[model samples]
Target chain A: MNDSVIHIEGLHKSYETSAGLFPVLKEVSLHITRGEFVAVMGPSGSGKSTFMNILGCLDHPSAGSYRLDGHDVATLDKDALALLRNRTIGFVFQGFNLLPRMSLQDNVALPLIYCGVERAERHQRARELLVKVGLEKYFDSMPNKISGGQQQRVAIARALINRPSLILADEPTGNLDSHTSTEIMALFESLNREGITIVLVTHELDVAQHAQRQVHFLDGRIVNDHATLHTEASL
Target chain B: MKLAMLGEAWRAMGANRMRTFLTMLGMVIGVGAVVLMMSVGQGAQYSIKQTISAMGSNLFVLLSGSSSTGGVRSGSGGSYTLNVADAEAIAELPGVQAIAPIHPGSAQIVYGPNNWNTSIIGTTPGYLDARSWPVASGNTFTDSDVRSATRVALIGKTAAQNLFGDADPVGQTIRIRQSPFVILGLLSTKGQGMDGRDQDDTIIIPLTTAQRQVFGSQFPGSVRMVMVQTTTQEIMPSVEKSMTELLRQRHRIREGLDDDFSLRNLTAVADSAAEATRVMSLLLGAIASVSLLVGGIGIMNIMLVSVTERTREIGIRMAIGARQRDILLQFLLEAIIISVIGCFIGLLLGIGGALLVELLTGTKVIIALSSVIVAFGVAATVGIFFGYYPARKAAQLDPIEALRYQ
Candidate 1:
C-alpha cells in the first residue's frame, strides 16, 4: 500500500551558457506515494518548471536517480521514455494546448488514440471525461471557438483520457481569471479526492491552497513542506 | 495507423485547397505534355508509314536530276537521257521484279469543252505492275503501242472527273498540247502520296507516244528517270548494290566520286522518318519530365513548412503515445496524396490535350493505357523521394521543446 509513484534522489540539472553551466536544481530529492495530492510553490527562478518537466517525463535530469512508477527514467532511451510517459503520466499545460482545428471531443480523444484505444471506445471515454469536466455542452466546440475557462476544462478532460497514474499540471490555472482559477482548482481538488495523484507546479499561493501538502522552494532547494490546517484531508 | 494517417493527409490537403493545387500544377503539366506529344508523334509516324506501305513496298525511285550525296546535280539541262535499253538492263538483273522507264512533265489536256492541267507520265507496260496501278474502267496499253508510238492514254480518277464529268468517256479523244490521243482506260484512285501530292492527278501513256507527240522529243533514247521494283524486301539491298554498280560503270564514275543518279529506297526513307520522329518524342518527353521533378521538390518544400507549422501538434501527439514512425508516416502520406491527386489530373489533362489536338489539327492520336500507369508510378516515386526529408524532420523533433512552442 506504500508504493512510491514518483521518487527522486540527488537530482541536479543545469543549463550551459556563455558564462558557465548555471545550475537549475541542486541535489533535489522527493517522493510521493500513490494517490497523493502534492503541490509545489516557488519564486520565478526556483527551477519548478525543470522539476515538473522531469516529473512529467518530458525531460531527464543531467545527473540524478529518478524513478516514476518504479521505472528508472534517467536510464530509458528517448522512445522508451516517451512510451513510459504515455502510459503513466498525463499533462495539463497552462496554455490549454488543444488543437485549434479539432473540437473539444477530438482533443480529449487524442490521448486515447495514442494509447491505441479503439475508435468507438476512445470516443465514448472522451465523452464521459468531457461530461465529468462540466464540458458536455461544448463537446463539439473548437478550442479557439470557446472561452478560456472552457478550453482549460477541455484540456483537463484530455489529460484524463489515457487513465494515467499521475496528472502533472504546470500552472493549470495560470491564464484564467480569479473566479475561473478557483473553479478549476476546486475541480482538481475533487479529482484528487477521488484517489488520483495530482502533482501541480504553481507560483500562485491561492491556487496552491487547494492541495493537501505544499512544498516551497527557493534557489532550487526545498525550503519548507507542510500540510494546511484549514483544509482537512478527504481521502 | 496507416488508414488514420491517410485520413489526416486527406484532411490536411483539403484544408489548404489553393496551396495544394498550385503545388500539383507542375506535375500535371509535365505528365500532360509527355502523353500528348508522344501520342501525336506516334500517330503521325503510323499514318505516314501506313501511307507509304500502301504505295507498294517494292518500288524504288531512281532520280537523275540530283545525285544522292552533297546535293550535287550531275548534268546541266536534261532531255532524253534514259531509254528502253537501260530499263531492260535493270529488268535483267537478279532479284529484279520489273522496271519502268519514265518521262514525266506537266501538260494541258482538253477533252471536248473541259480543260485541265495535269502531269503526263510516259512509261512502258511495266509501269502498271511496278506502281501497283489498278485499271478501273479500260485496258492498259500493250508493249506494241509503246514500241510503235501509238497515241493512247490512261487517265486517273481526278483527270477522269475533270475532263469527262459523269460521262462514260472510255475510248474518247483527249488532246495533249494540241495532239489528239485516245483514252484507253481509267486508273483507280490511289489517294494522296506520303508527301501530300495528288496521286490521281495524272495521265499515263506509252513512252513512245509521249516522246513523239506529247513532249515532241527529238532525241531517240531519253527519259527522265527509271523506276524499279524488287521481287522481295530482303533482296532489295542486293538489287540496289548491283544496280548502283552497273549504273556507276555505265556512267563511268570512279570510286569516291558521287554517282550521277540517286537511288531512292522507300524503305530507307521510311525508316529515317520513323527514327527522327522517335528521337523528337524522346526529347520532348525528357523536357516535360523536368516539371515533374520540380513538382516533387514543391511537395517536399510544402511538407517541410507544414512540419514546422504543426510542431506543437506533433508534440502533443507524441506525448499522448504516437511513435516517431507515426509522425513520419503521417507527413509521408500527405505528400503521396498530393502526388496521386496531381497524377490523376495530369492523366485526364494529357488525354484531353491529345484528343483536342487530334480533333483540331486532323492528326491521329493514340492513347496507351501504359502511359497512365507510368505517369502514376513516376508520381509515386517522386513522392517517396521528396517526402523523406520532411517526414524525417517531423520524426526528429523534440517533443518537450515542441510542446512549449507558442
Candidate 2:
C-alpha cells in the first residue's frame, strides 16, 4: 500500500494512579490499511480500550510512535491533532454518545459544525447521512427520545458525515441487544465494502467474527494477530 | 464571534431563559441605580440654578453697618449712617441698572373679617425691576407715590390670600396699624427663596410712606438696605467695587476705620449652593457603583456554575474538533450577551426611575447621554472582567477527562 491509514510502532501508555505508574499498553505495534476491517479483542485488563484511545488521538502514548495519515501524532499540537482527527478519523463510542438535547440531524451535523461548514450545507449533508442510516424519520427527534439502537445508528451516521477514510469504534454494540448488534455489524460490513477502513474493539468472539482480521491482547501486549478467510466468507 | 458562534451563545441563553433573566437583573439594578442617581443630582442643580436666576440673576445688597456713640456699643444697624442719598449716588454710577431702598418692618393688615400679620417692605417703583418682582394685578407705586408719602400698597400673594380670601386685593382698602391704605397692586408670586423664607408672604409700600407713616420719625432718610441690579451680569463685579468706593467716599470714613456698609452678591450665594450639588452628585454616583460591583460578582458566580454544568458539552465540542479558542469564544460571548441585554434593560429602568423620582420630588431629572454610554461600557467591562476565568476554565478542559465527567 502507498500509505497505511494508521501505523503504530512500540506504542505504550501508563496512568499515574496513587499506587504508582500503571502501564496500560506495552510496545503494541499495529498497521491498518485503507478499506480494511479489523477487530481488537482481549480480557478486561488487556488495554484494548487504551489502544483504541491512542488510535483516536484522544490520549497520548507514554513511549511510542503513532502515525495517522502520514502525520506524527506526538509532533502535532492539540489543535493540529484535532484538525487531523476531524479530517481523517471518525469515532463511535459504546455509549452512543449523542448530545441529549440535540436532534438526530443536529447530532449528525456536529462534526461539520466544528469544521466551520455553513448552516445550509451542514444540514443538507447531515440529512443525507441520516437517510443512508435509515434514520430519516427521526431527523428532528431528540437523542433522548430515540431507542439505544437508533442512537447508535445516528452515531454511525455522524461518524461517516465527514467522509473520513477511517472509523474507530470502541465497544460500539456493547449497549445494544443481540438483534440490534447484528444489524449494526451489518452496517459496518457494508461500509467496509465501500472502501472505508474500520477498527473496532469488542470482547465477544461472535462480534469479532464480523471482521476480516482479528487481534487479541493480554497483559497490555498483543499476543495473536491473524487474518481469517471464514470471517469474510460469513459476511 | 462569527454568526454561528454567536447563535450558539444566544441559543444556549435561550435554553435557560429564567436563569439568564435573573443573571441580567443584577446588572440592571446596578446600572439603573447609577443613572438615576446622576440624573436626579443634575436635575436638582438645574432647578436650584433656575430658582436663583428667577429671583435675580445679577443682584447684590448693601446693608448699613452699626455706629458706636458715647463709649457705648450699639447693636448692628442701630445708628443708621447709610441713607437714601447714598442709594441714589450708587444708582447713578456707570454699569448700574436700578437701585431700590428698603425700609423693612412688621405689620398686621385687616380687610373685612380677615386679618393677616406679615412683614412690610417699603420701597420705590424701581424695587420691582431691581428684585425681578412683577405686579400680578393692578399697578405698582410710581415716583410721585413715594414723593407724596401715599398710603397705597402692593400685597403679596400669600398675604393677599390670607387677608382677602377670593376677593381681589387690588383697588381695595386694607387697614395697617388702624390706618386704611388703598391697594395699588398684588405683587407677583415668588414662591419660597433658597433661604427657606417665603418671598410671597410680605407686602410692598413706597419708601417715603414707610419712613413717614410706618416708621413715623424712627430714622428719617436712613434706609435699612439698598438692592442694586446691574445692567448686565458681567458688570456686577465692577458695579460692586465702584459702589463700595462711592459709599466710602460719600460717608467720609477714614482709611483705618471700618466702612459703615457691606455688600453681598446673590450670585456668590448661588455658586456655593451649586457647588454643594456637584459634590452630592459625585457622592451618589460613587454609592451606586458599589451595586455595579456586586452585579459583576453575580456574573462571575453564575458563569462559574454554567461552566461546571456544561463540562460534558465542552467535551463533546472538543471531540468534534473545536479549538480551545472556539470554546472560549462561545462562553465569553454568552457572558457579553447577558451583560449587553442587562445594559439595555438598565437604560429603560434608569429613565423610568428618573421619571418616578421627578414625579415624587417635583424636581426635574435629566438623563445625560454620556451616562448611558459610560454605564454601558462599564457593564461590558464587568462582563469580560468576571467572565474570563470561567471561560478559560471551560476551554482548558481535557477532552477525555471532561467526557468521563458525569
Candidate 3:
C-alpha cells in the first residue's frame, strides 16, 4: 500500500432510482501500485464505468474506502476532491470533451486555469504537450477543425497538462477507427513506458492487450484479474 | 485566475453573438432611459433653480389693495394704497434686509434712429440688492438720484441691444415718452424668467423720476408696489406677520376690516415651484427605474437560459477538475461583461439622446458626472444581482448527471 497509486477496499456504490436503491458496484477491492498500466473491461452495465468514476475521484462510493495517490477520497469534500483530481489524476473521456469555442491550445490549458497557473506558463506548458502529441502546428485551430484522431490526441495532451500521477481514460479510443485506435494505444503505451500509471476502461480484447494487466467485471463484481498473455503477439 | 475566467467568459459570449446581443439590448434600453431621463429632469431642476436665483431669495411683493367702485373691483396693484413712505417704514422693521418701491409700465423708447418698445421699472437702488443683480458695465442709479428725481437710467442687455445695436449705451441718451434720459449703466443679463419672459428686456430708473417726472402720479409719493427682502429665509413668516400688523395699525383699519394691501411671499412661491420640479424629476427617475428593473429581469432570464444550454460544458469543466466556484465565476463574469458593456453603450446613447433633445427643443440639458457614475454602479450591481441565481444553479450542478446530459 505504500507505493500504491490506487487503493480500494470493500467499495460499494448504489443509485437511488424512483423505484428503489439500485446497486452498481458491490464489495469491490482493488490495489494498483505506481507505474502499472491496468485495463478495466466488462460488458454493458457490468459496473466498470462506476468503478472508473470512483478511481478518478469524480464520484464517491456509497460505502467503503478509496485512496487515490494517498488521499482518502471518501473523506474529502466536493472542492477538496476536485483539487485532489486536479493534482493527482487526469481524465480522458469517450467524447473528446474539448470546449468547442476555445482554440486547441486553450482547450489543452483549461485544467491549469482551474489550478491558478499564470497565463504565460500555462501557454508554454500547453505548447510543449501539444508538440509532444504531434499537433503543434494546429495550436490555434478550433477542435472542430481537427480530425477525430487528432482531437483525441489533443485530449490526451490536455489530460497530461497537469502532470498528474494517474491517467483515467474512459473509452479513450471509443470513437476512433481501428487504425486510429492502434495509434492511440501506441501513444498510451509510450506514456506508460515513461512511468506514468494508466487505468483505462475498454471492452475490446485487443485494446486491453496493450495494458500490462487486465481486470474484468461481471454482475457488479470483478470476475477476472490477470496479466495479459498476448501483449507481444498483439503488438 | 479571475482575469483568465473573464477571458473565458468573453469567448463564451463571443460564441453566440446574436443571442448575446439580444440579451444585452434590454440593459441598453434600460440604462439609456435612466440616463436620459435623469439628464432631462436635472435640466428642468437646474433651469428652475436659475430662475429662482434670478428672481431673488427671501423676497416679498406687497401690492396695494384693489379699488372698488360700486362692486366693480380692480386688481391688487390698481390702487394707490402703497407709497414710498410705506416702503421706508417697512425698511426700519426687524429682519428686513432691503426695500424697493416700484412703479412698472411699458413705454416706447427712442435712441438715435432706433425706436423700440420695452418694459420700464421705476425702483429705488435697493431693488438691485434685493434681486441680487449686478451692473455689467456702468454704475447704478444712486439714492440721491431717486431723491432728486434724476433722469439717469440703467439699460438691460436686451433693451440696450435693441436700442443701441452694437454701440455702447452707457453714456447714450434714450427718450422715454419724449423725455430724454441718460443711460447710467448696463445691467447684467438675467436670461429668461420662470414665466418664459425675457427678464433682460427691461429698463430700470429712479422711482421718483418714474412716478413724478414721467407718469405724473395723482397722489404724491404713492407707488404701485413695494418689494421687501428679509435677512434670512427662516424669518420670513415672522416678518410677514409683523409687516401685516404694522400696515393694519398704520392705516388705522378696524380689527374686522381687511387690510388695504396684499402681501405675497415670493420666496414661498419660488420654493413651491422648486419643490414641484424636484417631485417631477423624482417621478421621472422612478418611471425610468421600472425599465431598469425590466432590463434586469431580462438579464436574469437570459442567464438562466444560458445556464441550461451550457450544462454539458459545465460537466466537461468539472470532469477536468473545475471547482464549483470556478464555474460560478465563469458564468457570473459572462453576465457582468454583457451588462457592463451594455451599460457603456447605453451611456453613450443616452448622452447622444440628451444632446439631440437639447438641439431639437433648445432646452438646457446637463449630464452631470455623478449621474454617469451612478448609472454605471447601478448597472454593474444589477448584473451581479440578476446573475447570481443562474450562476449558483450552474455551480451546484451534479457533475456525474451533467456529464451524462446530451
What is the per-residue lDDT of model 2 for residues B234-266, given as tens digits with 9 covering 90 to 100? Answer: 888888888888998999988988888878998
Candidate 1 lDDT over A1-235, as tens digits, reads 3479988899999989999999999989998888888889999999888888888777778998998888888778877877776778888889888877777887898766555667788779899999999988887887888888888889888888877788999899999999999899989989988888999999998788888789888898888888754564432
Tens digit of per-residue lDDT, candidate 1, span B308-393? 98999888878776778878888888888888888889889999999999999999888877667778899999988898899999
Model 3 clash pairs are none
Write the residue-wise lDDT of candidate 2 on A1-235 in tens digits. 5459888999889999999999999989999888889999999989998888788888899998999878889999988978866778888988887876678888898888778899899889999999999988988999888889999999999999899878999899999999999999999999999999999999999899899899999999999999855844574
* Candidate order by decreasing DockQ: 3, 2, 1
Off by over 4 Å in 3: A232-235, B112-114
Instruction: Tell me the interface RMSD of every candidate, in Å.
Output: 1.9, 1.8, 0.9
- Candidate 1 residue pairs in clash (backbone atoms < 3 Å): B80-B222, B81-B222, B82-B223
Say which candidate scores most in DockQ: 3
- Candidate 1, residue A18: the lDDT equals 100
Which consecutive 10 residues in model 3 chain A have the weakest lDDT in total? A226-235
CA RMSD (A), model 2 = 4.3
Give the per-residue lDDT of model 3 (tens digit) for A1-235. 5689998899999999999999999999999999999999999999999898888777889998988888888789999988877878888988888889799999999999999999999999999999999997999999999999999999999999999999999999899999999999999999999999999999998899899999999989999999999856755
